[model samples]
Target: MPESWNYLMDMDGVLVHEEHPIPGASEFVAELTGNDIKFLVLTNNSIYTPRDLRARLARTGLDMPETAIWTSALATAKFLDSQRPNGSAFVIGEAGLTTALHEIGYVLTDRDPDYVVLGETRTYSFTAITKAIRLVEEGAKFIATNPDATGPSREGSLPATGAVAALIARATGREPYFVGKPNPLMMRSALRALGTHSANTLMIGDRMDTDIRAGLEAGLQTILVLSGISADSTAEMYPFRPTRVINSIADLVGNSAAPF
Candidate 1:
């Protein structure tokens, strides 16, 4: 491992699973902070703000500061601010997405909005979806926080932003620009946030299709962990491969010298 190496880690699978911290995840995070290593916990879930996520993680036994976390909502807001500063949007999501846009000086409105932004939510409102479709048809650009079609829940899989975005696309004949995982834009934004170059940064994730793919495209080395969505056999199905495939974050605990 490089002495100056930094890290970009996926939150759901790499550190926690279904609101519970994975084994050794806390130790691994502590080691990084203790060594003054720069790193960020990235997540495609746009339902919660970093502050909210920090509290959630703390309950799960992973003590992390809000500054150490990044979300697709934040990335989306940053992208929008760069594209059109102080823009307006018709948002369909929770406080996480709304708060991010608000913080970026984006107005949340429905009349002649600049964009129709979609994000993850527990309840998918038909009224909101209908309004989003109509707005897109009215020439408002479409944007989604992530491309994930489904999200995990205690009961089962729930329709996510991608699934809702697909419906809007089918109605308006326009595809949304996704700003989260699998899009190098988000990865680059994260790198910029950390003030680190991709060459000396490592991305740790569980999914090959999104996490690994995004990191690889963003010029960062990638590690695939089997503690989340992807199984050991899952990588073989992908066209590309992660630099390292480990059983879990537990394996990386107390072993900085191990080949990443």
Candidate 2:
């Protein structure tokens, strides 16, 4: 890797696990900050806004500015803004999603919406899902933040955006357009936000299906870290491969002497 390379890193598995910072994850971030390397923390979870996420990471000892954090909500909002400016939608999500849409001048309504936007939330509402189904059946476009079937929690895996989207799809017979990872649109949007070229960027992620695949499709070199969801044997299961594999972010800390 070159000295001028920028970084795009997954949030949950790469830097922290649930509510705690992964080993050396803080150091890696510090190294990047101290060295003035350009990077952004990416997450498919649209439950919290960037400000909320920044505070959450701070609690885990990861010192990142709000500007350094990017969420699926932001990407979705940007996509919507470009596709249909000032459009209305029946949104099923929390602050992150709603705030993003609001920032883009999108109206949130259940009446004759132009789209049905689905995002991650701790408590999925039956009433909202039903309304979403009705809206989609009535000709609203279906859109989802990501294709993740499950999200991690202290107790266990919880049904995420993808699962809920599947339910809506089943009822309405319409597959949603996912705006997050593996679509390349999310990665491209992040790259444009960071103002960096894909050739000079490194995408560090924990999932082969989402982060690595998205990075690869977006034309960036990818590194698979085994600190989160993927294990050692997991990479081989995928047809595509990462540029390199490492135990965790610890290996990359103070790696000035070696290729990143």
Clash totals in order: 0, 0
lDDT of 2 by residue, 1-260 (tens): 56577899999899988788999999989988998888999999999999999999999899989999989999999999999999999999999999999999999999999999999999899999999999999999999999999987778989999999999999999999999998899999999999898988889999999999999999999999999999979999999999999999999988822435
What local distance difference test score does each model get? 0.93, 0.93
What TM-score, to 2 decimals, does candidate 2 have? 0.97
lDDT of 2 at 253: 85
Residue-level lDDT for 51 in candidate 1: 99
- Cα shift from native, residue 257, model 1 (Å): 6.2
Model 1 C-alpha lDDT versus the unseen true structure:
0.93
Model 1 per-residue lDDT tens digits across residues 1-260? 57657899999999998888899999999988897888999999999999999999999989889998999999999999999999999999999999999999999999999999999999989999999999999999999999999998899999999999999999999999999999999999999999999988989999999999999999999999999999988999988999999999989877643445
lDDT score of residue 52 within candidate 1: 97
Clashing pairs in 1: none
